[model samples]
Target chain A: MSILLHDDTRVIVQGITGKIGSVQTKWMLQYGTKIVGGVTPGKGGQVVEGLPVFNYVEDAVKETGANASVFFVPAAFVLDAFFETIDAGIDFIVIVPEHIPVHDVMKMRDYADEKGITALGPTTPGILVPGKGKMGIMPASLFAPGRVGIISRSGTLSYEFAGILSEKQIGQSTVVGMGADPVVLCNLPKILAMFENDPDTDAVIIVGEVGGEQEEKAAEFIAGHMKKPVAAYIAGRFSPQGKKMGHAGAIVRGSAGTYEGKTGALREAGVTVLESPIHVHAWAEKYRLR
Target chain B: MRLHEYEGMDIFEKFGIPVPERGVAGTVDETLNIAEKTGYPAILKSQVLVGGRGLAGGIRPVQTPEECRTTAEALLETEIKGLPVREIMVCKKAVIERELYLGITIDGYSGRPVVVVSTEGGVHIEETARTSPDKIASFKIDPKFGFYPYQAVALLRRAGLDGKPLNACADILVRLYKVFRQYEAMIAEINPLAVLADGGLMAVDAVLEIDDSAMFRVKKMLSLSPEGRIGNRLERKGKEIGVTYVDLDGDIGLISSGAGLGMASMDIIGHGMEPANFLETGGGITADLLYKCMDLILMKPLRAVFINIYGGINPIHEGAKGIVRYIKDHGVTLPIVAKALGNHQEETWEILKSGGIHVVTEAATEKAVERLAALLNTSSPMSRS
Candidate 1:
């Protein structure tokens, strides 16, 4: 009953031969993700963590019926890998690398849109469906099966929130790290729509940060469409303007991407916006979301 | 990665987009030489990265060699927004019949490159876009097919351009699109694409910001303006080590695993206590690399250091080891507050405690910040030997 990923969502790892890919593949496997195969150019027929490797995604797709992909490819090769995955008819993809060229990200996002595929991130930790399946690099111990669907723009912050939720015995349904890139494929609104429809998700937690209008737009969508209770925690409230605070997307340009703007919008949307990550548990308890 | 006007014009010239003959000058002699070459009625533009150069009087239209000398001297001495004017761009002033705007930038919402054209040009485009949105015409370019001629023509025509101006604007737009694509630019703008009195089109002002991530692909373009790499010593050192470190006006040295986490840490360290710098060690960094990052953060005068790590790809133990090694080797006596979560958290806690470091066990950053603030309030500032 997860939002994007489930137990039978057969996944394949792209760039599985690389150091990060191999490590994450093992971690994803350990988290009970149904990793079917892997793809690494010139490394076909190789085995990584007992999964078969193919030179191309098409081969992996054809042989294993892998409908999802997790790209651990370098930033330079992300576009090519993305195109290949799209062409192979993979429905979902998680791009793990950060600092992907904005142009390439745009193209990948546009192509993914045209093809109707769910491409997650260029700098994301991917998605986690607690006690079921995980497709990202998030620590598995921090999650538990619950009714709250969590969506965030950060990996570490997602882990932090999940840890808080786990500590409070407030489990989650699915957690999606939309990546902190300025141009991400699955924005807050799109993921919110999915969360709104999921019956297993009684409430949703949005971990938003400064920069970009995604949070504002998400608030707009929630105000109009959302029926379930939602809580939010935004980072970078005290971050200085103009200076990019690590994330490519987390910059306060003029008044467009400020914490106040985002928080105001979310509060107006009937969402309980928490002042800190630890307060999410208390807020969730107050809301009485089972 | 934002190119100066002179550098932007260089790229425009390479793409055959019409630009007024221009030369960059660092000295009064160089300014005089370029002024002579470009002839009288030249424009002296200070080449600083920040905007509002025109409002700051960094741009001066000089009529004579004497005026050029005085203006260039004054501009070179001036500082716009705290950034000194290191160089001035001297160019032949174009006769403007009409000023138009043409720019290619990524639309954050659509996740696509967009070409924005406006007949109401030269003034604050942001203001125009905010207030009079209908004054400008925007065309989203599909990156797969790129900016087509028909799309450019349609946008230009919609912006009240017709006949010669329309075709000329279309040509420049296409050429600008090429430059945008070729250089992998985040923003390629000709704020005032001036149409001269004689129906000639020229880029009066140019701004091109290349995507910093695409630097590896455009080494030659970067090498052309190596001196443009402007930052402090810590930033430069961070760049060298494949990390991001931005100096701030605070006393608490901070380090975190992810960019979002780093920024969130900075935000949580509230109550008038600013973070000294923003440091993201990134994922899967080794203990040695973390030690180097600690060394950079420790270089600054700090009352306390807050190390927050939520290990996903980056193991908490590695960060703990790095901090332990740094403390043991450097004998850093500054009051330090650390919070480690995720993989190997127990071991990481044990290592830091064994190294005689007090670790903040609060999982929430807000509580951790409160703990750090309380610790700092109780202990006097350490005297650096």
Candidate 2:
């Protein structure tokens, strides 16, 4: 009943020999993510977290039947890594690199969409089904296997909220990082629809920021189709216009992507919108207590 | 990155789009010389990135060389929107019979490129879309396919525009699409695509904003970033150090790891204290970056500092070390409260505690912000804006 990642979603790590890649791989392996092998162009024979490393994604796929991938490659090489994963016929791709050029990301996303592959982020924390499997850089300590599905555009805020929900004995079915890039592959609506269909997810919480209209679009999808009770906590309500707030996609433009704009839309769609991150526990408490 | 009018013209010419005859000048003498060749009644526009140039008197009509020289001098001396004008664009002002709008932008909701067109121009398109929704029309570009003239032409026709003129506009759009794609522009617009009395199209004004994330690949944009572009000093400093810092008219300084958490922290802090600036490091926090961020917020005399960070991908230990180093190096006496957790939470808290930082261990950020507000209330006021 989980979305994106499933029991059979065998994964491979790209740029596994890199420092961040190796460390995160160790953490992911520790969390019991079904990681099969690794990929590093030059360091093919090297091992990371006891996983066999290969130069090409195809080789790893051929050997392990890996259907998913987590990219830990640098920004300069992300496009190539993205194409490699897509070519390898990977169903789900999680991009960890944050600074891939906007134009490069556009082409990468376009190609991914063309291939019908679900790609996560250029600057994403990755997705977690909690206790099932984890991907990307989201710390596993905060996540617990539960009933609510959480979708967010931020990596840290999701963890911050996840910890809050977990503290209240409210676990999550799955938490998806919608990525931080402006031209990210998935949006809130797409992920929201998937969460609605998942039997394990009874309620969903959308963690949105002020920059883009991901929240607004999801509001439309929720107001019409979603039957499950939804709660949302949006960030950047006080963010200044034109300031890139940590995330490339989270910028307050002229009369657009405002926190009020997003929150208002979500509220109109009949969702419980939290006042601040501090109120997250209360929001989840009400949902769980119900 | 919003390109200046001169830089926009260079892009327009590079894309083979039709624009009026123009030349740039950095000095008064250069302005007179360019105006002399362009003939009398040329437009002198102070090349500042801020809008409202026409109303702000940044744009002036000069009939004589003396007027041109004087206008250029005053423009170069004065500041538009508090930004000192570094360059002036001298150009032949063409006659405008009518105004039209054309733009290529990323549709945030759909996450795709969109070509927007309207006969109603020379005004804010958003305003037009709000007041007269039928005046403006937009066609969302497919993410998979290339934006061709035929598509723009079809879109224009569907938007109630017709005739040979649309083909011309469509041609310009195709070229503009090249500029939009190649430069990785978030927005490339020609507001007031002036229709001459003779029925030819000329881009009256160009607004080309390259995506800041893609600026690294566009090598030419490297030097001009935050150069006379950002009016705020601390904001410019933040950009230089690769951190997201927004100066506000408030008191408490803020530092957070993620934008969502940063803004959430702002909301909690704003309940009791005014946030002086919004600062977030994303996943790119280093000791030096954090040190510079602390220095940046400290530039304005603040009441207290509230730092809410979580170490996920970002190294909280290294970032905490930077904060400790900054506090010790400057011998800071301000009330600094930091709520740090995840990955290296213990080491981060230890380092902050050593620097006299009020550290909050629990994940809830209210604890840190609440402690800071209590501390600030007790501390003496440092009057600043």
lDDT of 2 by residue, A61-176 (tens): 99989999999998888888889888988989999888777778878877877788888887899998889888988878788889988898888888987887787678889989
Give the worst 10-residue stretch by lDDT in candidate 2 chain A: A243-252
lDDT for residue B173 in candidate 1, whole number 0-100: 96
Residues B8-41, model 1: lDDT tens digits: 8877988899999889898999999999999889
Q: What share of the true interface contacts does each candidate keep?
A: 0.51, 0.44
lDDT of 1 at B352: 86
Q: Which stretches of candidate 2 lie over 4 Å from their true place?
A: A243-256, B220-227, B378-385
Which CAPRI level is candidate 1? acceptable
Global CA lDDT of candidate 2, please? 0.81
Model 2 interface DockQ: 0.42
